[model samples]
Target: MTTLPASAFLGGFALTFSLIVSLGAQNLFLLRQGLRREHVGAVVAFCILADILLMAAGVAGIGRLLQAVPGLAAWLTLGGAAFLAWYGYGAAQRAWRGGAGAAAARAAGTPLAATLLQAAAITLLNPHVYLDTVLLVGVAGSALAAEARPLFLAGAGSASLIWFAGLGYGARLLAPLFARPGAWRVLDGAVAAVMLLLAIGLLASLRGSLGIGQQP
Candidate 1:
């Protein structure tokens, strides 16, 4: 068996961290939960665990299977896009109505299972997660020498753990800032903007995939 270099591990870590750092649905949901101070540890752990599971599958070659199934990808992408768009619209509506922060904070009163389910939905419902992790990351990891693969996996896993942890815990510090109504409005506006951008990007990608917006 060959041993992977430390550099390979670092490279993998950077890739994973960069990819996960985006302001997507999963991150936004986690951030909201964190701000509410509800099951912060559980939410973070679930995200990290999900990342580990997905990364392992990617390293194990499941990503290739997903790539080979274009039909499956299309269906999953459509479903994920619809869900995201709906969620984004709903969030935006709530923000526009005002008191969204308080409402979200109150939602923290729900059962732990409910929160977990919400997190899972945000993470697993999106087909892009599989494409990003299993296919893209997996293919990248496969390019390294056999010995370096494990190091790369370690780096990616570390990024997930660190990122989710920071997202969950760091949100608490912003609670005081959000206590002011104006600040809450700004946060909601920011969240709405991120959600809308993600939705638009997904739709555009789907249009391109369907050959609806191609140049002659």
Candidate 2:
């Protein structure tokens, strides 16, 4: 393998961070896990690993193959929208019945397997993740020479690491603020709103796709 300049690594890092820094389903889930102080390490690690694998695959040119498959993206989007709607309804219920005691109980009672499953769904079910990681990042990295691609991947992976680690661990600093039932209610309400909004957006996209396909 040939050595590449530090710019390749920095470019990857900057680009990946820019793409991922937004508060989406995955990031919101991680933030909630971090706040609960339940399996924060496992959740963060899983997210980082998942992101790296997707990025690597993107760099490996699997993005094109995925795009070539008909209806696959739409199917994923449908699944994601349904999951988001269900999750949002759950959050709304929690928000409606806000109580510090209930929140604490939930934090303590949630199973690790279940948490990880939600993490996986939040990460993998969303078509945007594939588009951002595989198509956008992958395409950018592919433009570089073969030797420089690794450096780019390293940079992108580093961004995922730094972002998830900080989001997970740094949430402890807000424990004092979230100590109140009111705070829990507000947070859950916001989460519910965002999740539902995202679900609606996904469904709208699918509708648009269907409309376009139906056109003569």
Candidate 3:
């Protein structure tokens, strides 16, 4: 039996936590669900499962397949950007209208299946998810000795589990603050801004890839 250094597990945990701690599209959606207190368990579970599967596939060399198909990345990026723009617009409209309390009431009545589907779209459709889990994390895992890969994956998976659980459940602690429509408006506005910024960033990256702004 081979003894893997503790660094493998620690490194994976730290890397994954840092990557996901940011306020990206997935995080925004998760936060919204958490705040709304609707299907939080299902949403968090799906997200954690998705991360584990993606990271595992990446470790198993799926990232190489993705790299071989550059056009797919472009397409995914385009799709993600368009979706973000649309979602951002909806959030902005909600913020402007200021019926968040009512909206939450309505969202509470939303079906679990529908909620899961939305969660799926948000998690699966984002190219950055692939980039982070498949390419970056995957490549990192592949670099490790075979025996160490499991420890790394365990660490990474643990981070996702912990983070999502906290984000989903911890949000209820702010239920009092979110009880106010005004607070919802502020949150929706912030969500809109973050989504739009992320969309713009994706578009910019796509353009750079296409060499659109380079001076000849």
Candidate 4:
């Protein structure tokens, strides 16, 4: 095994953080769980573990399944994007119609099993996670030398660990603001926007693939 270069580690860290920093279902759920102060550690661990496995799989070139069969990725993306759109629409409905409200939603207090299962679903069931972590990050990391791949994986895993830790633990700072329904409205609206934007991107990718397949 060759010595891992600092550059490899840094590259992985920067790239992972850039992708994970974005707002998504997983992050939103994490934030909610944090504020609710329910099983925060389990939630954070599940996310980090998912990230690590996905990133590792990506760096190992398992994500090439996406390129090997774009059709597969496209199909999976279609279903997943549809689900995301529906989720976003629900959030939008809540924002506009004044649905359960944040505190009330929190008070609903799902069982820990249910909460953790949802967390797993958001992380593993979501097609975008596979696209971003396995396909995108994997292809990017594959650009590095073979010996440096481990360092890259380490960096990516570290970023997930750090971000989830901070987000879950630091959520209390926002608890005061999120207490207000108005604040919940803004948060839900932001979540809807992110979900819709992701859906748009996924559909666009499928369209591009179809376009390419039809040509010559």
| Top of the candidates by lDDT | 2
Cα lDDT tens digits for candidate 2, 2-58: 346688999999999999999798988888888889899999999999999999999
For each candidate in turn, the TM-score is 0.87, 0.94, 0.93, 0.82
Residue-level lDDT of model 3, residues 25-123, one tens digit each, is: 888888989998888999999999999999999999999999898799899889888888888998898898887554755465679998788778777
Model 4 error, position 199 (Å): 2.5
Tens-digit per-residue lDDT, 90-170, candidate 1: 667667766765566566475899889878877886877887788777888887877788888999899999999999999
Could you tell me the TM-score of candidate 3? 0.93
Better of 3 and 4 by lDDT: 3
| lDDT (10s digit) by residue, model 4, range 1-216 | 334588788888999899999778899978867877889999999999999998898888888765797567777778767867877887787677554664576577778798788788667757779978998889889888898888888888899999999999999888888777778788778878887887788778777867865656
Best by TM-score: 2
How far residue 170's Cα lies from its native spot in candidate 3, in Å, is: 0.5
- Please identify model 3 stretches exceeding 4 Å from their true place: 1-5, 100-108
**Model 4: worst 10 consecutive residues (lDDT sum):** 97-106
Ranking of all predicted structures according to TM-score, beginning with the best and ending with the worst: 2, 3, 1, 4
Candidate 1 CA-lDDT value: 0.80
Q: Name the runs in model 2 displaced over 4 angstroms.
A: 1-3, 212-216
Models sorted by lDDT, best on top: 2, 3, 4, 1
Q: Clashing residue pairs in candidate 3, if any?
A: none
- The lDDT of model 4 is 0.82
